[model samples]
Target: MDLDALVARRRLGWERLRVLSRQRHLDGAQADELLDGYQRVATDLSTVRSAAPDPSLVTHLSGLLAGARLRSAGTRTFSWDMVGRFFVEDFPAALYRLRWWWILTALANVVVGLALGVWLYHHPVVENTLLSSVEVQQLVQTDFESYYSEHAASSFATLVWINNAWVAAQCIVFGVLGLPVIYVLWQNISNVAVIGSLMHQHGRADVFWGMLSPHGLLELTAIFVAAGVGLRLFWSWVAPGPRTRLSSLAHEGRTAAGVSLGLVVVLLISGLIEAFVTPSPLPTWARVGIGVLALLLFLVYVFTLGRSAVRRGITGDVDESLEAHVAPTAG
Candidate 1:
């Protein structure tokens, strides 16, 4: 446990490990020597720290071993460029590549909602069963509009944003189940359809569309995108095609995760519109136009920027250097 003796015994091995760690590239012989020296130095450091406990010696060996570890396994650091590329390329590319899936999801949901609305409109008995005549009348006349303005705009926006984001997150996170995503979508569609039907019946159809279209355009689209991604995540394993099931799932799941991140912003915009525009005294056309404009901007970002990003080989994944490698083939 003598400090001097301990330093003398391990200092040479530790120096060798340090030198090897500093090298940018190692020849075959050097690489083998590096590994050998690394192992020896690591053991020496452990023995010295336990027996000698000299702060200076322990510190030097510890630093040497840390450097060797880094050299042996490699390391990475986050950079601003990575953040910039993610927003400009990775996020949009994922959305664009998965465009068809989401488009189909949007269409299906709209159709289901419309069908449900029509059916409910035709069946007064169904409405009566769900809600009393008086309650239905209140919903049609005042409750529907009052709901938007019931709270102050800022707090309402925050609440709506958090609620919508949670729903979208659930869709993506639980998307592997497949059925959950559909169930969520069905629940949403049913709510809208029931309210829509009641409004139409009460001659408040204009009010219904006006209240919804301002925020619903983008809000629903974001939800549809999340649902599509979730569905795709489920489908990746079911029909991975040429790729191994795990590989396909990982790839698609990574892309789907990007949609989740992107949708947070999308849903926020929708929430803002719903709070500020929907209940504002602004003309319905102007408010709806703002929503349409927001949706259009998102679409352009996806189709235009996304297509370009994909062509450039961005897949909303970590850069290739960070990606896992396949083992070399014997052939």
Candidate 2:
């Protein structure tokens, strides 16, 4: 009821809280004092809001309370420093560490795609069974080429990015199953093989490569990385080595999450190339060159920066400070 008297009574406590809240470090006594001050001031503010509801007083106390609350509980504010470390250290390190998994995956997919493409090309009967003559003709003549240019570049890029990101996410999320990741890769590679064979059958091999190469190189690599990371996650638990299975899975799971985020950007670049560079009138060489450059830069970033980070003991997992403490185990 008596707002001014209450303010007079609680002013020192509020001021102490303000000072404590702004402090960079506090000893145990000061921490206790800060907590005590915060509770008293909160009560003061509540009483004022209900009895007097003085605008200025309420505003001042509210601000003080907010700061003290944040100070006491601590807040994880955004930091460009964390972001920089993530890209420069965490992401590349994870990519580098898991390079074998994805490299093998990419190689296997390529072998499958090329093998199936060759098989289908040599076997005209198989293509006929998959698609009627009319459908195959339509696909080779217009549908395949038009697919890239039919939508506006920006909208198409967005759609491609979203779709590819979802696929990458799925690979990481379903990695534990192992079989699902393989199934996804098989489905993706088979479709590409079928299309490539059909395009080659129609004597549009040049056109097919020209349209797909500009984006497919990086796009498919990102997918392979995701699939590899997923398989690694599954294997972590299956064969945890010295660590407990749960511990192994958690470590890999965190790394997998980071890889998933990094792949979003990777896929975005590929989507841009697919929507803009692929359909553009630039010579096929120039477009493919850009795609090659992008892929090379990514590889260099992983092998160079990522390898260095790994050497420095970064595993793409959260910082040790953020990780939960685990029981010590003998090697």
Candidate 3:
């Protein structure tokens, strides 16, 4: 029965199972079973991982590339499309779950910010704190007319073009740890609350629009996305749905990471707008148009790019020569 190989496979499966189980949506029985398997095989998988020949990661990637090539040629071999679909199914669901918790945290921050802003507005210590940071000083003290009128369109385009991708990347990359995600979520929510309070005090809601909507919102969302990626990892460990806690966390570890790629693009777009457009002389209506367009593109890419990977194809393995993704925690 090739017991050694069978055991190796089971060990690897348990590792994957540990990650998927972190979702916190699984039945008690399944969770217990997965947890047991994860513990039993973890040591063995460690050995397999360390002792295995160069770990053959390339082989897995190669197989997928080969499948893509075959599909391009319309060959009648095994259905490899499922591989991509499987990944999209899991990644998006994880992202959705992470966002939910972030929303809840954000709501709490909003209340705190409103309370603080009201207090500060009445007391008049707000601008002083901002002066502590040169960046904040620049943002707060500058006249809206000079800033927005100078080069609004170019600023808007650059900001959205660069920072949106940055947000996505951070959410994907640093999310492995719980703290990074928490920090990101907290920072964004707090800033919004603080800014809202200040604007109310100054009777400058309209003015705030020029500085904020131009690039701040998009840049902020990118940061949140970065945090979301980390939160996904954190949640997998803390909650673990239908599997054991450890098993659910393990599954998340195996996924491909692209948070850095997204981060670079996001910075370019958002940074440029923050530097140039928000302070420019563009009309309110013009700013609105740019923000709207940038947001729509983000939605379209997220919902559409992976549809081919998610919505089409069988839910299982396709052909030989290609190794199937090892199943989660087996007996």
Q: Give the higher-lDDT candidate: 1 or 2.
A: 2
lDDT tens readout by residue for model 3, 55-98: 45324323333433333224354566744543444434333434
Q: Over 4 Å off in model 1, which ranges?
A: 1-80
Whose TM-score is higher: candidate 1's or candidate 2's?
A: 2
Candidate 2 structure quality by residue, lDDT tens digits, 200-234: 98889999999999999999999999999999999
**What are the runs in model 2 whose C-alpha is more than 4 Å off?**
1-73, 327-331
Candidate lDDT scores, in order, read 0.86, 0.91, 0.52
**Candidate 1 local lDDT, residue 121:** 95
Best by lDDT: 2
Cα error, candidate 3, residue 183 (Å): 3.0
Question: lDDT of candidate 2?
Answer: 0.91
Order of the predicted models by lDDT, top scorer first: 2, 1, 3
Off by over 4 Å in 3: 1-119, 122-174, 242-247, 253-256, 304-309, 313-330
Ranking, TM-score, top scorer first: 2, 1, 3
lDDT of 1 by residue, 1-331 (tens): 5767766776677777888999999888988888898777667666666665567766676677667767777776789997687789999998888889899999999999999899999997998999998899889999999999999999999999999999898889889989999999999999999999999998999899999999999999999999999999999999999989998888887788777887888899999999999999998899889889989999998989999999988878666644443322222
TM-score of each: 0.78, 0.79, 0.52
